[model samples]
Target: MKKIQNFFSGFLIIFSLFFVFHSAEAGFFDWFFRFFGKNEANVKKEEIVLPKYYRLGVSSVGSGTVIINVNEGKINCGNECRKIFPEKSLVELTAKPNDNYIFKSWSGCDYTPNEKCKIEMNKNVTITANFAKKENVVNSQQQSGSHSSKIISSSVSQKSSSKSSLVSSKTNNSKLSNSLSSAASSKAPSSRSSSSSSIFSAELMEDVFLMDDDGTLIDSDNKLIDKKIVEKFYTLHPQKTYYDFLSVFPSFEPGFQGAFHSIVKNDVKGIGGPQITSSYLSDSNKLIGVNFLGFGFTSPRIKTEDDVKNNLHYLVHETGHQWLAYIGKEEGFSTATHYTNWTDTGFIRDGQQWSDVMGGSPWKDNGDGTVSEIITNKQGFSKLSLYLMGLASQTEVPDLRIVVPENPQDQSPFNVHVRGEPKTISISDIVSRYGTRIPSYQTSQKDFKMAYILLSKKSNPPTMSQIDAINYVAKYFPSEWNFVTYGKSTINSR
Candidate 1:
């Protein structure tokens, strides 16, 4: 009986071993590894892979040329006509209307609703900027005069990393901060009419429309879309980096970013856009060789009260673009161009759903082979973004991942459903490639200057309701900027 029992036990042990071995071979242990985040594929590599790039082709109509500028003219098209831009790259196109002809309108971009052509190159596409030979082109945008604030929004929800709301009427000094500030100094900008609508008052520019062959965009209430009202505002207040226009034209699209000039083509040293310096002409201007140009048309007529209330993210996202999501591009991180899965706008064009390109999808590592996208309501600029903006130290940034999809250009990585392999971009590699951000975050400028104006169509007075809305928004904007930056930055009209 003892011999039989031993034989049976040995047989059972052998059978169990064979079953376990077969299960292991068949991926039965995969769940365990995944649960523990110990999958072999989950190991993060401190390396960079080439980013997915899409071709941007340009076609000219009439007499002008569209200057395609990206990466400080790497493919500054129009001697080239067609060039490929990396995924998430912001492409700015300006119409150089030869002498008499004015830029008629851009034909290809369904997203660009204003004269400033800021396109997020998500896929291979061509854009056509049309210039018309006009008998008399009154380009009022070039004409000198002051105008008021205007910005437009598609109203996508956003995520903030901070839980505290700092919009109190009486802001305590203890609550204010200057992050990355050295031991001696860290304070909010003195409230010098900072958030007052009366102080940041937008001068009204009545709409200028052409009926008898001026040939600019004239459809919605005959409001001329070709000449941005804010251009005139720039002529008036050339000092401010940003212009907030309370506009009448509901056709206007969104917040656009630009630089006045770049000394060199190196993106790290304020190349395409400045990260650590102020490029615009303000009282506290620095010749960092880069300046940020932000313009938007916010019409309360078009935007609901909820939209106006929640509009801070749009401002934060666009301004953040001035210094974000581009540093790790060489190391395989794609610049995220406002793609979100939750917003099915349902507004279709060309038989397809709206591109839904407005807010960005920042991501995080789940420690497994897969990564979880930082959803809206939690999506502020990442620490990596802050570092690029000269707002955070290198130590604050972590090992960020770039998702390598099965198909590199198979839609944008912003889509949550898009599965891919996670490749980590280490900070050391970024430091090695770009070198440490000069003037470091400790000494970097955290306060920015902005101008606000109210835009009214010619002969149309801005509604009192509109003025109230703008005032309310402007009042809380500093706190909003403060919150989104996680205390790394602030803005002032002064």
Candidate 2:
């Protein structure tokens, strides 16, 4: 009977042990499956839904035709134009006027009356290209006969009178002209045009004045000399001044005024040097500033005519800064043209951290102290710098892509690709591919990693497209990235 009781107790104990073990194992399996299932459900929930696309309509007025070019398709309209294009697509329209007609303006489209019009098709858009008949002023004048002749004679007389006034005024300053003419005649032929003679004379006078005065020669302001005097100086000393060459012509192309300014102020070197401050028009982005750096001067010890001629490249470098300041200010960046002290390791020792010249090129002081050589003459402008200055054309700029590996755990390298314009990809797509948190300024680790990767992969000077991509990332994303991101430490910390 006791033996029977012992067997029953052992069986009961064994049964209890088995029940506990099975329960624990089942609980663990349930929790594990639940966690994985939750993740899978989230993945399914995040699926992307493409936006609905709509058509764009284009038309023309008068004798002109409208040619619309979109990423998806192209439409040429002679009279009434209509086409279908994807929503949010960029559309470029060109106006071609028929014979005896000229392009007038664009209607029903938010664009200036340029030969080309560009817009983003967010919804159904209708644009009209207008043209006007070209008026034959010459034919009208001929028809008028005697009256037209009188008007023509009067116009010629006015022009002649203006020319005579200019010549007479210049002749009044005969002392200055004669002095310069004598110096110019020594170098070249005496039988030169009046304009040529004036320019040569100015050049000689500038050289003489620069040599005669010490570096302490200060005009009203402590910076340099007066701009009028400087202009006259450049006119006389046209030998090496690039500004003189450009100013001799009527006007500059759209974006070359900064370049002209740089040429004129290349040799201006005194205690203060050149200083620029910009102010914007009320309620507009139009930038206006008094450029005090236009006058050209130099240190007495360093004021050799040869030194001035040799440093012509400095004008190019400095002009680049002016362009940057103007465009950057207009684009809502800091008005300061030069990089701050925090940005550059080597900067002016006078507690001023401004970049010497957009920090584009390096200037080395010759031990002789006559002139400094801008070493990076071959490297015109960095891609980032060019874009900021509005010098990069649409074709020159490239699209940006952040490439990821198939396996997140894989030790393979990641990269930022700068190529043609990318197809419309939503932010959710980026998050899914690159992970929930993409590199941003807020995420320092990810931001630095991406920046270093781009810096390593970038071309020596970088392309305009590459720079554009970097800029987009910085401006839109959380990164405070820019052209100086990688080279800040290496800048001369003088």
Q: Return the TM-score for each candidate structure.
A: 0.43, 0.22
Backbone collision count in every prediction?
31, 11
Task: Provide the lDDT at 315 for model 1.
Answer: 52
Q: Candidate 2: minimum summed lDDT over ten consecutive residues — where?
A: 450-459
Best by TM-score: 1
Error of 2 at 30 (Å): 44
Best by lDDT: 1
Residues 1-494, candidate 1: write the lDDT tens digits: 99999999999999678668667555546755765677979567775443466667787675445666555442323322555556788877776664345677886674665555778878877788887776744323221233332221212111111121222212122211111122112223122211112212221111111111122223454333423333343343445434322222221221222212222112355312443433334434332222222212233222333434454555555555455444443444543333233222123223433221233344444444444443223335556666777887889777655555556664553344344566666777878877777657888777764433444433222333343344444455667777656677876534
lDDT of 2 by residue, 360-415 (tens): 22223222322121222122343334333333322332321222223444211111
Q: What's the lDDT for candidate 1?
A: 0.44
Clashes of 1: 31
| Model 2, TM vs. native | 0.22
